[model samples]
Structure formats: structure tokens, C-alpha cells
Target: MNDPSPAAWLRPMLAVHRRALAAGCAAVLARTAAGLSLPYLVKVGIDEGVVPGDPDALSWAVLGCAAVIAVQAAAARIETLALARVAQRMLHAVRSRLFAHLQRLSLDFHERERVGGVVARITGDVASMQPLVAEALVNLVTSLVTMAGVAVVLVVLDWRLALAVLAVAPFLAVLVAWFRRRSATAWRRVREASAAASAEARESVAAVAVLQAFRREEVTLGRLAGRYGEERVANRRPIDLASMFFPAVEFGGAAATAIALAVGGHRVIDGALEIGTLAAFLIYLRLLFDPVFQLSELFDSVQSGTAGAARVAGVLAQRPSVQDPPAPVPLPAAGAELRMSGVRFAYPRADGEPGPEALRGVDLVVPAGHTLALVGATGAGKSTIAKLLTRCYDPDAGQITLGGVDLRATSEDELRRAVAYVPQEPFLFAGTVLDNLLLGKPGHDRARAEAALAAIGAEPAFRRLDGGLDTPVGERGEQLAMGERQLLAFARLWIDAPGVLVLDEATGHLDEESEERVQEALRRLRRGRTVVVIAHRLTTVTEADQVAVIDGGRVAQADPPAELLAAGGPFAVLHDRWLRSAAAG
Candidate 1:
């Protein structure tokens, strides 16, 4: 009931290409007119030229038929070209808009939705509209016009034979209406099933490493086969319906033609109708049935296309959960102080149900040029604090300020430039090392990137590679070791030189040597910048100027590491456990 109509989704796209669509429509109409003129020309030639023994009339009629064929061919070519241009332009616009919108959407949206489903909507669903836009829409118009022209000519030639043809019209209409209702639901299932299969395929490919490691290749294959089977069943339903519908339409056409022939033959014998007129009536019936059958076939394509359009429209209708302020405040100069006041937050459940709070009313501050390490068990909101600092998710009931300005009020560009966050798992795109590094600060050349790598002591890893900066990172940086990826992340941070840095266990994946190197790089990078570390390693905690121990979505302790240990609080207990673990190792 809440579903959008096909026109609702298609209207905006059509409006954008209205001029081209209008031209295509004109061409289709011209082509239909030329086609309709041929039967009439045959009638004229038979009555005035062939029977009357006039060679000039017959020659002129033959020439007219030739001209009509030529015009029809030219008009059809122009119509196809014009409609194709409109369809391709619409596809480009829709795809670009969908991709850009996905980027603008909040991380919350991304977290809730499957990446494969989103990709399918962008690629498969959008592409499915091709038939509707390029062919079905235009062809449908042409069929209706041709049918109308044939009907008029049929009646004009012999009213009684036209009556016989009109007799089957109601039955054909009923058949089409029945097919439309059934096919819409069937095609919708097909689209849903296809999307599911696409999502499964993407997930399986992306996690092939895990599958192979667990030796579950057969299991995954079976799962994929099941998904594909569902898709096949969904696809078959509409096709089966169309197969039956087409034959029924053919039967109606045959019945009408038979009636026209038998009735018109009797009339001609009685001298009530001219032989040429009876012949034209039979030709007109064929013309009428041809378009009617074509329309029925086009209906199937339209149904499928509408199903795809509906899915695409649903995605485009979502407004971003996060948006820029109407009037943003200016960031202060020479101030890198970061503070959180009474911050409380919760991540919304994907199913729109209530979920546990990720963070509770908490307060913390770090000086303009100091470090604060957040230490806690997993899910104790350590990473949530870092996320809030980076403005990935705003707090439910608190204000986070950077440089004495509320983060929500600050411009996105300025805020991002001032605050940089590096997560535990660093991601590299499928490109050269230089390309990944340049993403840190746009317009910086290879020299600057090399300098940044050298500054972080990451140059040695790249030097071992054949092409250094030009070496491909492979998909998601799978080519490099985890340590190498983290080092590159540090090099990126150095290039950007932000006023504040938030690292959520940035060295978690590194070995001892890599960890030490990264820590040394961090020490240099922390100078004159507000640093917030979501500490996973004890070494990182010991080096922080202040430690914040979080428990149950709230900060239980906030003090220097030495002071907190002496106090024998939650931080003391955690530090003791960490020390014991290290000594045992």
C-alpha cells in the first residue's frame, strides 16, 4: 500500500529529458502514421489501379508504399537514437546522484545497511530502468497510436467487419488487466530476489579468506546456490505468466481475424461490400492485432522496469541523518583544546527498536597540547568517545567543543582539518601508495609524501617494494602487512598535520618492533597537538599525561597514571592486570 507508482519514480527523470523525449515521441508518431498509411494505399491501388486497369494509378500507389516504408525506417532510427540518448543520460544522473547521496549519508546509515544491497541498488536496480525508458515507454505509445489508426481505417472500410474486430477488444483488455496485476507482484519478487543474491555474492567474495580458512567452501557454495535458486524461481514466475498471456492474446487476434474474413467474404458475395474494401478490412485487422500483441509483450517489460524503479526511488528518498548547520560558527585560531561536557549517546538499532546506550553523561578535557588515554574493556565506550570527538556521531545529550567552538556549529572542512581520527584497522584503497598518501592533504606531490613517510620511519617498508610510492596497495591494502598499513596511516597523519589526533588502538595490529616504531612516531606526532588515544596496549596508557577509566558507559576514574595506580581505583586494577599479563608474556 505504501509503494510508489511507476510514474511517481519515472516522472522526474522524464521531466529532466522532456525535450529529447518529446522528439522521440514525435518520431514514433510519424513512424506509426507511415505504417498505417500502407494498408490504405493497397486498398487504393486495388480499387483504382488494378481492377480499373490504370497503370499510372498502380505505379503511383507502389511509389507511395515505397515512400511510406522509407519514412518509417528513418523515423524509427531517429526515435531509437533519441530515446537511447534520454535513457543513457537518465542512467548517468541516477547513478551519480545515488553514489553521492550514499557518501553524504551518516555512518549510522552505512552501519545499518548491507554494502552489497546498496551496491545492487546503485548498479543493478538503476540499470534495470533501461527497458522502460528506452523502449517500453516509447513502444507503448506507438502501439496505442497504431491500434487507434487501424481501428479508424477498419470502420471506414466496412463497419460490419470492424464490429467483428471490436468484439474481441473487451476480452483483450480483460486479459491485459489480469496480467498487469499478477505480473507487477511477480516482477517485484524477482527484483527482491536478485538483490538478495547480489548481496550474498558480494559478501561471500569479500569474506573468501575467512571461508577458505575455515574450510567452508562447500558451505558457502551451498548458501550461494540457495540464494541463486530463489532468484531463479522469482524470475520464472513472471516469465511463465507472460508465456500464457501471449498465447491468449494471440488467440483473441486469430478469432477477430477469422470473424472479419468470414463476415467480409459473405458481404462481398452479396455485393454489399467491394472486394478491395474487404481486403483492406482484413489488412487493418492484422495491423490492429500486431500492435495489440506487441503492447502485451511490452507490458511484461514495463512491469519489471517499474519494480526496479521503485527500489531505486526508495533509496533516493532517504534524507541524510546528519547535515551541516544552517549557519556554522568560525573555528578559533591557535587553539587545539578539546573538551566534552556531560556527553550521553546511543546508537540506534537497525530495526528501529531501542538499543543500549553507547555512552552516558561524561566529562573530560585535555589541554591545548597534551595527551589523554582512554582505557577500558571492549564495549565500555572508549571508541565511542573517540567517535564523538571526530563528529562521526553527535552525542544524544551533550556538547563536544574543539577550539572553544561546538563541533556541531563548526564547518565540516575546518573541523576535519583540525581533528584527524585513525581507527584500529587502517583501510587503504586499491591504488598506488602515492595515491593513498595524497588523500591526506590534496595537491601535495610525491616529495611531500616521501618526506611524511620518512618522518614516520615508514619509508623503509615502501623502499623494499619494487615501485615504492607507485606500488599498488591491492584491494583494501591486503598486499601489505598490518604493520605496514598502520605505518602508512601514521604517514597520512603527518602529511595532514591536524591540531588534534584521535587514535583508536592504532598500534593494535602491529608486532613488537612495528609497535615501537609506531609509538616513537606517535611521540613525535603528539607534540603541540591534543591527542586522545583509545588505549589497547599498556605501553600507550603509561605514556599518556592523563588516564580516563571508563565503565558501564561512564568514566569511573580520571587522573594521571601514577596517581590513579596509587589510589587503587578501577584504573589501578586494570593497570595491575595489564602489568601481570606483560610479565607473564
Candidate 2:
């Protein structure tokens, strides 16, 4: 598919900064007029000053040219400054909007997109437009105006010579059209190839530890080399096109200059053209090509900017699938019940088709201040349940609500304040432990953060850190052990202790000592709140108010722990196996 024009989005941005754009444009015209006048002054010095032996007039002409140069420099500086400020402001808005929109986009968008591809839209793609905005824009205006000014001067100097020089205009126009279409296609492929390569690099780096542990470094390098080679192949097409285009334009300009020089030389000899005018024609012939030549550079900017803008625009065009109602419904007070009724959902495929249903008419609930542990085999939809509860991915054909408020109706801010979901692996932003802790509740101080950690019985573990509560967690809390990271997450939970909390297999794979610590923390933390716990290990759900056995995307049985054990069904078999496995661990 042909990419949408960057002008679709860029025009409005340019319009918003119309005043600055006007200023820059004014400077462009002024600079062009001043610079173009110099050749006229040189012509006059020869015709009216030197030919008549008027030294005073020649000195005046020289001084006039110098004055015009100084003015041109000033106007050029103003144009550069004005456009620079405008570009910075425009890109700042684009980057911020891109980032904010990415955040607002539904989870499925992210699931289908590579991390590096998404990041490049904001970083690399956005940065590519800088030249188009700052330098190329200025060059575009300067070249066009200089050529137009030169065209008028040449016509006045001698229409006969101007007509001869103008013969190449039609050919140049056709060449420009060809280059624009071909280069745009070539550069677009380059952009896509670059983004793919970036994604490969980032994925490799993120999984480097896994690659090493599995002794797959050489294979990983081979894959990376393959992607780099793909990028090289993509890039070569544009380089080849440029190689053909630059020389073609240069030859056309040289031919036009040669013809203009020959024609003007004859006119001057016949006294049909003045010596000064012939000299001006020679200067202007070169000047005319300056802008013609600039078209090639301008095409690069236009193509690159167009490619980047299209990607950025595509992201911005996405409307969030999950959004608050026109008038948001406020969540009820703390300890509201959480409910899912006939929740049916299927994950979307990257190919634009929907996958088979993961949850089929599933219905479940947790009363206020109650703990419901969900026990299920892998792929039985336990994690899917947690995600739906938190509104990460809304059910395709059902409703999930908290305190009688539909999740879709509740504003994101209020819902976030009311519900908390802790996954098997929680992502921790790069910061001190205290900073992560402070993310718990607004108005929470350092002492309060420490207290929240203590409330979950994980304070002592963190207090032993080199910086204690102030220690850096590194990226995603990698500086800490698994249990330590779990404890920090629980501590953040302890701060708000929202009305609804969802925990997904938190202690499934921790070391014995770390599991014990996490278990202890979980025990202290599941107090006076509606909690939905997803666990494969039966041992973790012993203290849950009720245990619900999930099988084949439906709740097969649910009862108090002791009651379910006595029933001797699937839960009983799972409990027996879990007991042996827990002991083995």
C-alpha cells in the first residue's frame, strides 16, 4: 500500500505555528532578493561604472553589493533561527503525542508490535524529520526563490538566451517526477527495514542472558547478521537510485549552462546583449541549477520525512479500543466486589484474524473483602481472567465490573486507584527502592514507604540493601533477587490496598527460602480486600476463603479449601500431585 502523505499531519502543525512560519518565509524571500541583487550590482559596475571609467560609481557599486551581502546574512540567520524553533516545538509535540497515544492504545496493539518498532516511531522516525523541518525547508524556499529571481533576471537580460537556457526545464521537471516516485518507494522500504533491524537488535540484547545460558550466542549472532544484511540490501536500492539521479541532474545543469554561455556570447558579440548582461547570464545559469540540484537533496528529506510521518501518523490514528464512557461512572468505595459475567474473549492474531476463544462464557465473582484462589492447568485462562479484571483487554462478549460499575465505564484513573493487578513477573521502573515504593499511594512519604514494606513483612529484606530503602533496583528490579522483587511489588500493593487485587502465580517458581519469604508476604498482604489469586500450586491457596478449580476455560468446582479437598474430584488429584511437587521442590 502507498503510505499516506506526511502533509496530512504536518500541514496542521505548520498551520499552528503560522506566525513563526510567516517570519521564516519572510526572511527567506528577503535573503533571496538580497543575494540575487549582487549579480545585478556586478553587472552595473561593469556597464555603468567600469565602461564609462567612473571610479566613484564603481566604488559605490562595490559598497552596494557588500551591503546587500550583509543584509542577506542577517535574513539567512533569522530564517534559520525561526525554522529551528518551529521544528523543535513541532517535534516536541509529535513525540509527546506519540508516547501518550502508545500508552493509551489497547494491550493487543502492543502484543502485536515489537518494542523496538514502537520505540523507533518516537525516536528514530521522529528524529528523521529534523532535516526536513530545519535545513531542507530553508533550502527549499531559498532554491525556489533564487531560481525564480534568476529566471526573471535572465529574461530581462536577453529573452533569446533565456529561451535557450530554458530548453532543459521540461526535461528537469520530468526527471523530478520520476525521482520523487521511485525514491519514495525505495526510502519507505529502507524505513521498514531499519525498524525491523532495530527490533532484532533490541530483542537480542534483552534475551542475551537466555542466549548465553542455552549456548546459542553463535546462532543469535548469525540471525542478527542476517537482519543487518537485509537492511543493507534495502538501503542499497536508494543509494543506487541516488547515484543515477545526482549525476543526471548535474549533467542537465551543465548542458543548460553551456548552451546559455554560447548563446549569450553570440548576442554580446552582435551588441544585442550588453557585456554586463552576458556576465549576469553566466552567473544566473549556475544560480538556476543551484535550486535544481537542491531538488535531489530536498527529495531525500521529503521522502525520509514522508516515511517517518506516515508511521507516526498511523500510530496517532489508532483509536483506543478500551476507553471510558462519555460520562464516566465512578467506582464505589473501597472493598467493592469484583465480578465477571459470561466473559468470552479471543486474542487477535497478528494476521488480522481472531484466535480461538481462550475464555468461553466464563462467569465468576469475589465478594468484598474475600479471597478467591483460582487453580487451573496451564492455558486454562487463569491469566486471561486477571487481565480482564484489570481491563487490560476487555472481554469480547461480556461485562466485568467492580462495585456495580462496568470496567469500560470507569475512568482509567479511578479504575487504577480502585484495582491493582500483580502479575507473575511485575515490571519495575528504574529507580531507587523508595521510588518504587512511593508509586503505591499519593502523599506517601519515605517513612510511609518503609512502613508499607514492613506491613508486608518484606521491610527487613530491603533494609539490608547497600542503600537500604534508597537502593537502586536497576532495570526492572534486576539488582534484586526474585523474592525481593516480589516483596517490593507486594509492598507497593500494601500502600493502596485497593478494593480489588489480582495476583497471578506469584510464588510458583521461587527458590525455597525466597518462596517462603514471598508466601509470608502474601499471607500478610491479603487482608481486608477482595483478592483473586491464580495459582497452579495448591499449597499457596490453602488459606484462601475459597478455591475454584478451572478446567477448559470454565470453573468446574468451587468451595472452601477443606470442603473441596473432601469432594475428591479434579482439585483432589491436583492437590495430591501438588503436595508431592512442593515436597520435591
Candidate 3:
């Protein structure tokens, strides 16, 4: 889809609430009509009632004026309420769609974007459109209608006075055009500055712990201050322009009113016009210029909204880099068997240059229900292999298969159901223990959840908590210990029970006791499943049926642990170093 302009983006939302929008428009017109009638009513009271000393005419005119005001007030209230409803509903739809699209986008897209910026788009940027969508558009319409009505009434009162009023129109248009050009640019800068400030603040707060650990609080504070300063500087230009706009509009209205009064006063003196008619022309002048002033004021909000809509449209237009095949093949029931043939892959670089290859010519196989452990130094592509097997990224120049079915040809749903990858750092949402557990297998009640936790020997950890299964995990599971979070991850996997498992340094961050507990759980979880472990510690490799040593994006060696240890290859050297370090400790 092409990126929608502000009006185009709002059209669908407006269509959804078209009935309310129509009613609001009707209300605005009714209110404007009532307001326009007041000047003529004043003319009637002065000429036919007060000047003639007719008590009944005077009383009737006063009553008529009062009735018009009452109607105007009622209509104004209806317009306000109706427009507010439409604005809120449109905002709700916009927010929901943006959030859903962000989720559907590929992980590569997210990795390249700032979380703070994305959050700002969903929150502050979306909110900036409220004034424009809910009130400014309606106000613009109402002001134009009021202006037109007053113009017609002025002409009917006396063409000479109407011509005097019309003299200001050209100057008013020029002033408005100038203000719009300046203020639009100013307002766009303001929105950009505001978004930058918001992104900086969000990032700082999210990484407060890191800042504190590195003793860089002052540096972060300085950066935030700089961002806020830019936002303040950008805001000043629009505010100065708006201040000039309103007073300039007022001056034009005064000039036009003065012209009408001077001309009409001479005509009344010459007996060419009635006193009431001249009085009505002065009142109509004010009414005519009122809408012009209001529209000028609304211009700022409209500009901000336009910029926000553009940013939102850019996000919605992004198609995911990784997508499901149009016609996907189904994996067989025995698809747990995993293989990567001549696999080669590289990450994408920001400047469109080729990134260093993370994996190269990697041939490997793991039969169903067996475990293969990959041992390598950091950045040697151990995790990359796990990522490939789980289809996080397709190999650039090779094929991965499960049960002889190419990974790309298989449906995403089937592939995900068949293989599960647990990363080094386990993430938990803000919820209760039971809520996090239920995410793995929805609709399973407490009894089933407890069984999954118990099977991994993690039930006691939860039982020790204040509320057991109902205990709040806090944000990102901060309330729980790191080991506890890891155990919950294992328990989740136990419930999920995928046919294949990819453990990417799952126990790398745990302490000795925690590692022992997790290793016990891993043994139970691995039964009848094809398991691939990215080994960080030498201990994990010892039990694997076959150990593959990765070096410089290639498979350096693959053999049983005993044979590899005796061969004195890369794996032997790594194990010997680990053993020496262990003995020294």
C-alpha cells in the first residue's frame, strides 16, 4: 500500500463514523445560522422597535434574540459532543492498527529501528492528531460557513458597506497564506523535535540500570537535557508565528470594521441608509472576520497532524522482509529430523554493503530423537546455526530441511510447532506465574500448568513464592531471580512439547546451582525430541552423541566427545583449557 496523506489516512476512519460526523456538521451549520441571525435581530429592535417607541416590537425582538442565542448554545454543545466521539473512536482504531502492524513486521526491521521511536509513534505522535481530527476540521468547516453567511447578510443590509468589508478580503488572504507557509514548516520541526525528545527519554529510562552500573548518570542526564533543549528551541518558532497570526487577523478585522462604519455613517447622514442597517453592517463585519481568525489558529494543529500521519503511514506501508510462502508444503509427522546442507549466510549491513559471513558451507545432520551439541567461541556462528534451523533467517546460499522437506517450502505454523528455540536470556512479560505458563498452552487449567512445572522440578520454586502460581512476576519478571525465570522458560517448553528443540546457550548465564537444576530439567525435556544445544560450557558437550566444533564460519570437526578429546583438534584444545581453568578455580 502507498503511504497515505493525512486526509487519505483519515478518510477511512471518518467513514466509519460518518453518521456522527454528518450530525456534527449539521449542528455547526445550525449554530452558525443562529449566530448570524442575531445581528439582523438587533437591527430590527433598533429600527422597528426601540426607535419607533413601540413596546411590543421591542419586546418581540429581544425575545427573538434570546431564542437565537439559546439555539446556538444547544447546537454548539451537540457539535462538541458528537465530534469528540468520532475523534476518540478514530484514535482507537489508529492505535490498534499501528500496534498490530509492528508485531507483524519482521524481526530484522525491529532490530534496525529504535524501540523508543516506535513507542512515540504509537503514543505521542498519534495523540498529536487528536486536535486536528476531533476539532480543527470541524472548526475549519464551521468558520467557512459562518464567514459565508455573514458575507451574504452584509450584502443584503447594504451593498456599499458590503464592498467596504470586501476590501479587506485580499489582504486577509495574503496574510493567511504567508502565516500558513511559515507555520507549517515551524510546526513540522516542532513535531520532529518532540519525537526525538520522547525517544531519548524512553531509552534512558529503559536502560537506567546500565547507566547506573557504568556510573554514567551525568552523561545520560546531559544527553536528555540536550534533547529537551532542541524540543524547546523548535517550539519557539511556531509559537511566535501563532502569536503574530492572531493579532494580524484582529488588525484586519478592525480595519474592515472601521471602513464599513465610516462609509455607512456618511450614507445614514445623507439619508441613503437606515441607522439600524448601518449598525447591522458593523456587527456583520465582526462575524465575518471571526471565522478567518479561528481558521488561522487551527492551522498549527493541522500541520502537526499532517506530519504525524505521514510517520504513521510510513510504518503501515512497510512489508515484512520475511514472509510465509504463498503455497507452503506441510512437514511430515517425522519432520523432527534436521539437516543443513552446504549452508552459508551473512547479516545485512546498514550501508547496503555485504556483511561478514556468519556461517559458511556448514553441513550437519541430527536424526530424530538425538542430541547434537555445537561448541565454538563467541561469534563463531553457533547461535547463527540455531537461528537458521528455527527459520529466523533463511540461508543465503544453501538449504535446511526437516524430514527431507525444505525449510522454506514448509508452512511457518508447522515449522514453528515442530521446532522451538530458547535464547540465552529468557524474557517474561508482566503477569502472574500462571499467566506466563498458560501462554505456552492456552486453555489448559491450573492442574495441567502445575504438572508441567512439576515435571521440570520447578513447582517448589513457585510454591515458595508469596502467591504461588498467582504471584506477580513484575515487569520483565524483575521480581523473580534470573534462575527462576530460566526455570519458567523450561517449564513453558515442557508444556509446548515441540518435536525439535534448539537451546541457544540457555544455561550460559546461570550460576552453578541453577545450571545443575536446569541440566536436570533439560534431560527430562529432551526425551524423544531432536535436540541441538549451542554449548558455552565444556560440560554440556560431554554428553552429546556428537559434538561439532565451529571455527571461522566453518565446521572444524565433528566426532563423539571421547574421540574429539583424544584427537587434539580445536574441540580438544577448548576442552583442555576449560579443564585447566576449572582445576585452577
Each candidate's TM vs. the true structure? 0.95, 0.96, 0.93
TM-score of 3: 0.93
lDDT of 1: 0.86
Q: Write the per-residue lDDT of candidate 1 for residues 1-585, one digit (tens) a residue.
A: 123665765688689888999999999999999989898888889989998999999999999999999999999998999999999998898788889888877788788778898898898888888888888878788988988888888877777778776998999899988999999999999988999999999999999999999999999999999999999999899989989999999899899889888888898899998787878787888888888777787877778788888888777677666567989887755437889999999887866554789888989989888899999888999888988898878888989998778999976777788888988898899998899998877799999999998887778878998988898999999888888888888888888888888988878878898888778877877888899999988999989999999998999999999999899988888888988998998
Best by TM-score: 2
lDDT of 3 by residue, 110-166 (tens): 877788888888997799889879878688878889888888888788877788669
Candidate 2 regions with alpha-carbon error over 4 angstroms: 1-3, 440-443
TM-score order of candidates, best first?
2, 1, 3
Looking at model 3, residue 441 earns an lDDT score of: 83
**How much is 86 displaced in model 1, in angstroms?**
1.6
What is the alpha-carbon RMSD of candidate 3 to the true structure?
Answer: 2.4
Candidate 2 residue lDDT tens string, 1-585 = 134667777888879998998999999999989988888898999988998899998999999999999998999888988999999999998899789999999888898789998998899889988877777778888898898889998898788888988999999899889998999888888888888889999999999999999999999899989989998998898889889999999999989988977887887788888898878778878888888787786787778877888878888887776787789889976877888899899987877677999898888878898999999788888888888888888899989988888899888888888888888987888998888887866587888898888898987898788999889999999998989999999998888767778888788768879989998898888877889999766667787898888888888888888998998898888899988886896
Against the reference, the lDDT scores of all candidates come to: 0.86, 0.86, 0.86
